[model samples]
Target: MAVQPSRPLRLFADYLRLERVNLTERWMKAVFNDADLSESDRLTHEQLSDHVPEILGEIFSALEDQDLDEVEPSIERNARQHGRLRWKQGYRIDELVRELDLLRQVLMGAIDSFAQGHPTFTRRHEERARHFVDEAISFVTLTSIREVVTERDRKIDEYTGQLERANHELLLKQKLVGELYESRMQITRSVVHDLRNFLNVFAMALQMIARAPARTNAALALANRQAADMKTLVDELVEYSIVLGDNNPLATEAFDLRVLFDELVASCGPAIEAKGLRLVHRFDPQLRTITTNRLKLKQVALNLLTNAAKYTKVGEVELDMRAHGDAHWRLRVSDTGVGICAEDQQRVFREFERANQDDVPGAGLGLAIVSELCRKLHGELRFASHEGEGTTFEITFPLRLDPGG
Candidate 1:
């Protein structure tokens, strides 16, 4: 004979199908009425009622088929939906878990009501009801926690990306501010040093005129020339300040390189003679007139030649101009003087930085100004030196020629 179905199993299946709607209503009312579930209660009735009926239908099918697989997918999906909803709605995880606990209580209460109304009810029926409800609750709770963890990790990654971008922007701003500060300090030091030199010359001219009234005309001429030089220095300083804005215009012209070299040598001859050092110059035969900023180039040559004369005592200071290539020329100023030490070489191109030799009368702005001017002219300046031997500065610039000149 075939065995009959168990009474408790049949009764449980009948209870799930017939009482599913009523049980869901009771659970919703309990959650909304509870003071501890204010966040869930804030949602509309339709939103709060979402997925509850489907979950009940899955449980009912599982009971009828005697297979938990019938309800597994529904349980996992409902848990994830609830986890995401509560997160968006500002509900705590513990509060959502509490609502699940209330669902179990409502289901068990309905089972007890069915037992109280039926005459054939038994303890076995209660145990089977508890088993199904407990299993469903455990699966949902675990899945919900997993979804919450995923959402939290995603938020953390977004926050980290935002912080990294902010840090990068802050570092760029700091670098730009530091560069501006250094530029301003360099300009101030150069102005002060150059003005002091011009003022000294002016003062000496006035003293000579007062001491020798017979030569007043000659002294007055010297003072007038010194004043003109001061004016030129002021104009140069203004040009440099505007260069920092990257808008200063270059005054280019065609000038004979040989003539410029001769003028420079003659201008500095007296200083070289006074220091008892020889001045030597050599030029490549192919070198000729070129088009460039003549005044700026002259300033560069004058500064280099003056520095060479100030340092050298006995040996010669040599100036050489040669054709570097088809498109370039190199100017070299080499001096047999007290050479720069290794530690001082690194800072020699910085404004107001001098070598260890303090006896040399200089404000330490010559090489620094040369470096800046080279950059403005789109050229390169390099040097080699050894203590007690010599120093040589070489600059290479593009050979831009004028057809008209």
Candidate 2:
């Protein structure tokens, strides 16, 4: 293998860098000083600024020329310019001289040797110089554009994710607060009804005792009646508190409708009697083997029935249950009460809502609890009513009883 001369090559590359600098300096100086000179001087300055670089580059073809003697005049003219106008000032022109010398040395006798017909080293040196300048410009442009694009994409991604997170947090807070307000309203309505019922029963008992002829009978009856009324109110309040727990766990079980209906009717008699309304319940005993949380379902049923009794005036309140299939049943409660207005129907399920025509006393969660309970049992509920006529709530509960049993 032939060994390469590395030191000669390094000097050769430096030579090209200085050559371009010298050419650039001459071109700028000629443009500034000779822009308005006389026509002949203008021609001379244009050759120095532009035409000379082209003539010198002709060395590659000059090497192929059979007569290299004719190119001598141009080279000698360039050499003379380097000594006179090109190398005039000590401070300003010294830079041009240094550049010219550096360029001449890095040429490394290539042009001279090529002119002397040494073609082996010429093409290689030309390629090396062109590649260095091209690559340097390309690398700088690519680096700057890449940095700008990368930064823009990063900021866009961060902003999109930030907005999504903010919206998610807002929805979560809205849901939590709504659940809280619902629980408080349910508790308030339950307390109000229980309190009123207790007071009414107490008043009835006191009046009966006050009319008694004997002191002994009046005192004994008063104490007993008051105790029973207090007990009933306490029981109802406890059940309401259990259902009103925001995170309460309820038990589902199988129960007969005949037994459940009788208990509900007897338990709610005081509240119904106080409102001067009659209560009616209709359920199918054969299809009543339903699997549900008996206490919770009972609470739901009683609340609906009681609300009907409280709202309706001079009309009968009815609770009716029917078997749809082995898989589900429909429980419909209709009242001859003040019907819910169409505009207020949607808002009736909202917490703390009371209609403008709603003359009854109850917080607005009776239907909301019914809706939630229906969801827990995999059921569906709907209602229809006419204004001032009556309202009918229809619920379809899945039959959770063992189908194959």
Q: For each candidate, what is the lDDT?
A: 0.77, 0.57
Model 1, C-alpha of 279: deviation from truth (Å)? 26
Sequence-dependent TM-score of model 1: 0.54
Local error of candidate 2 at residue 153 (angstroms)? 3.6
Residue 340: error of model 2 in Å? 2.2
How well is each residue in 256-337 modelled by candidate 2, as lDDT tens digits? Answer: 8678877877787666667777777787765757787776677678777876776777767888888987788888888887
Candidate 2 ranges beyond 4 A from true positions: 1-162, 171-240, 246-250, 254-290, 322-329, 350-372, 375-379, 400-405
Best by TM-score: 1
Task: Supply the global lDDT for candidate 2.
Answer: 0.57
The predictions' CA RMSDs to the true structure, in order, are 9.6, 19.3
Clashes (N, CA, C under 3 Å) per candidate: 0, 1
Candidate 1 lDDT score at position 279: 85
Clash pairs, candidate 2, are: 312-337
